[model samples]
Target: MKPSTPTRLFLLWMLTAPGCGLLLGLDDFEDAGKSTDTVSDTDGRCHIDEDCPSGLHGQAVCDDGTCEYTCAPGFADCSDSPGCETAITEDPEHCGSCRSPCAAHCVDGVCNAPVDIATSASSASACALMEAGDVWCWGLLPNAEGGSRTVPLPERIELPLPALQVAVGGTVFTGPHGLRAHFCALLADGTVRCWGTNQLGQLGLGDTGPHEGAQIPNVNGIREIAAGTDNTCAINAQNQLYCWGPRSTGLIEGDTTPAAPTLIAESVDQVSVASFHACAVMVDRTLKCWGLDFYGSLGLGAGGPTHATTPTSVGHGSNFAEVSCGLTHTCARSSSGVSCWGNNANGQLGLGSRTNYNSPQSLNLFASQTLRAGASHTAAVIAGDVYLWGSNAFKQMGSNDAFDTLLPVRLSLPSVSRLALGERFSCALTAEGRVLCWGANDHAQLGDGTLVSRATAAPVRWR
Candidate 1:
């Protein structure tokens, strides 16, 4: 979605956007009422998109200090009563507004993702996120809004559905490995009913067993679940971590194999684990990680032929605000700046050269706030512009050289609000709430429909 010219502004228009906001300066909002230092509720005038800033997307024409989200054709307010939606939903051009629409239901005036929602009948493939206080999912355990709304005994798909995905299309969570797929979880309830590839006891059926259908009768206590190349990690309500699968590094750290949800970390926030390693942030925002460190994917200062058997600190970086783990490397944001360490074979470290580092190295960015690490590549945006480097074999770096970079390489994308990096691909949620993706498309990871890869940035179609 291109930036529409702003039309109005209102000071009394109050809205809150979580973790994402675009503060349009004088030049960006480009409306007629941009004064030097006067912005009162009575100063009604439109100038640009940010004029009547609230959770609404697009530029609003401010009339009497109120901004009306472009109420054009196909753009209708899908906000349920009492549901505080940041943007509009049901727009053919922009569904669910602000990046992704609600996960599934408008129940209770909130968007719920694909999970074991109460309003649902069975497990599904995906569910929309709702601001309301309920949940929903898609697939075929029964049918919430499909064939029927009532199913005797509440039957669901078989367990152990493979290939689970969260934060999909519109923040909906996807479960059920291959078959119709049965799963559970939503605001009211969340149980670990997973499917697919149960080798090495990942299904947590009390054995290194595999189930084609939902495993474990209920998984309500699960608070966080992360899927990796092969292994999976889940943190239960008690702040414990659990893992199952091949190539185990004892991440669960207990006498019993974490074939079930195990406890790990310092009871703070559990960071997402990647293919070979896992890390998390503590109550005070400190970082603790474990698992394989093949090429320094551990992010610990001293990198070598050593790996942590349990969660440990990284290179004296206690204040590590945020961290992202990739296939063989890790990048994190610290008080000072962004730093990376580990395998440089594909330049995933983003240290400027294809040289591997056994220690954390800082990048020479003008001013950086965050970083995201991919399989063997890394992407970061300092200020508002984006930069990527490392592992261009699949052209995930958005450069023509196909050579690994030791420094931060720039990707000329406009301002972005949120960023999510996949195994070998990267995605950015723009300030306009539209998703723009570039880089590798091997598995349609770029979501641009084609097996070809991109050497530069491009807009991905969500339609």
Candidate 2:
């Protein structure tokens, strides 16, 4: 039954109170699909504020027995939807009025110069490469908050010079090593610098002095950089591979000289590293991999050596465009399609099965522009559509489901230009220059300013 006028007002006030519990039944709320404009107490519309869902537009309320979204004082709703989806105070599309687009861009809802954003992720933290090569980092860090370990928002990080690329990862170690995460930046001048935990020399600074950041001596003209648990590798302009940090032999990188960068290979075009292995794209478009292969992550075939101390060709093709390494698997893209090999536990291989493959198994997905691998998940950008497979324990799949998928599933997002996968989270850069992240946010890695893990894409809020 509809409540009386006085009773409706009281219910609305109670619903808007801070920390007040909702005692209303489900039937009291109106459906989102129902428009509020026609709502009337006698017309079987909404009779009270509780009759409408809160947060429908911003925070909803009942006015004169009619349900509508309530904006803060001086705030105006500009979106043409049933409720106010955008606040005129800061909405770029409705800066001051409905359908009024921002002149330059929108920031915090206000029109300003549109910002360009590029993102990178480590196991627990994330970094954004912004305009003019400035970098901002957030999430969990070793020295954050008296060592309490979580930075909930983005903070500009000072580097010796503007960085072109950044890589972050947590190295797995035992006893005194445990897990130490580190960061590395590739400078515009073609040099590489590193910071954070140096327990295993992941920083590549000659000495393990736990410093803010330091440039690696003698190594210059670097074109690309990739990091794993306790090691860092880079491809020089001359197409040579240089590596530092602790040894994880058979990954084509081991400690022949513990204090300096060691030359691993030459004529390499690109490289990627994860837990205990690494892969590289050769000049001929062929792929090679090394390191622990107990899970067939090397894609060297079941007859190949269990561990390859040197680079071994992956599969029998030279048509690969890129390759990525995960915790216990490897994936690559070719003119034909995407394929993965190694441990399929949790379906990280994305072959529609939990069974591991010793040889390259075609995923039959679309041709990919780029791809990335996480601890137990894989993501790819195929003609702008983002597809994820394998583990969704933390919703890294971005499918809004916690259950794992053995096959590729397209994410509900705009065309993506690039992708990055973390231990239990995923992030992407849309063609529109926006950064969106999802999955685990216990350490605020998703950058929504909340530690809440998201099952769907959330814009990376920048203050």
Candidate 3:
């Protein structure tokens, strides 16, 4: 039977209704299927939070028809990959954050941990040899204003090559011009580089003009280096020693002109210099000294010549391991123990008396691993313990007493591996790579983030 017109229209509408697949035109059905496929494909792309994949070390979220990734802390997506591939905490090129580079190794997201320290005897500056062969310095350092200023925190000093050792010297000029300090570093390429004041050609750059940055000295093949008041000295791999700068200390014979590096001695194992005197330990384990013999600093016995232009033997007949020269005194470590001589006005000799000794006086201490002498103080490390004596004017001995100590006193501290002394301050490096300082902070040589002096040991601030 044929359907009515009105009934035909109603049947067409019902065929097109949702979930009703009754008879319909082929083109219309094909269009409806295409629309359904488009919706299904869009939903398959990302409809729920779980539909997105998390990137490596990152979190992903489906938002606004797109997937966004968020990197975790200490990680960054520095590449085209879908993961955070860079770990900034351990990366030297991106230490603590992206694009921040470290001159040396990175530690716990921090850069430039110190491995060795150098302090000046007449100036308030100190330098550290970083683990990565870079150098960092603080205290009274040269500023960009063509003068010197105090730096409470460490700042990396630019160098042409990686450093193996560092030394500082020069006296704080009492005049209006600020400090007259200088710095030198033994580069990894067996050359020596220096900077700062060159009033006396201390930088070894041939001229006395002030230098702003690192400059190569007329010296090379250096294994060890030491800086003194207006002078510098170094020992080569061939056991030869060379010195330059002002001839006040007689480091070089002839006129009083500032000289380039000149051979001073041979068969030298180690060398140390001070304001007016210098000393060296020969390969035979004997000690020798030269320069101004103020208060018998030369250790040539009483009534000797006031000064010896050439190296003179310090006869004690003991096998010396190390020797250090102070402003007016000297101390040495040997198989027998530690001994000191020269000026003792402040008991810097570590003896039980204030009387000066024209010869080496035994400290009666045993198994001393290291010893160091400052302007008017002395320090020694025995069995991993630090002992100090002499001047307390700036609390250099780590004591609150106003009087100087006449004997060595142990400091309450962790196991110390090394020590560095300034004009009126001291620092010790712990076996765990930490640094502690005490005494004067007039120019922030203590590096504790303050300008106030301390009578006890304090940890150095890394920031």
> Top lDDT: which candidate number?
3
| Regions of model 3 farther than 4 Å from truth | 1-111, 144-146, 173-178, 214-217
Predicted candidate 3 versus true structure: per-residue lDDT over 330-402, tens digit per residue:
9999998898999999999989889998888898788988888888999999989999989999998888877
lDDT of 1 by residue, 181-200 (tens): 22332223455555443434
lDDT of 2 at 361: 89
Residue-wise C-alpha lDDT for candidate 2, range 11-97, written one tens digit per residue? 665566432332222211121222344232345566556555444324566677667665443244432333433345555556555
Model 2 has a clash total of: 6
User: How well does each candidate superpose onto the true structure, as a TM-score?
Assistant: 0.59, 0.74, 0.78
Would you list the C-alpha lDDT of every candidate in the order shown? 0.49, 0.71, 0.77
Give the higher-lDDT candidate: 1 or 2.
2
Comparison by TM-score, 2 against 3, better one:
3
Ranking by TM-score: 3, 2, 1
Clashing pairs in 3: none
* Stretches of model 2 off by over 4 angstroms after superposition: 1-122, 144-148, 171-176, 249-259
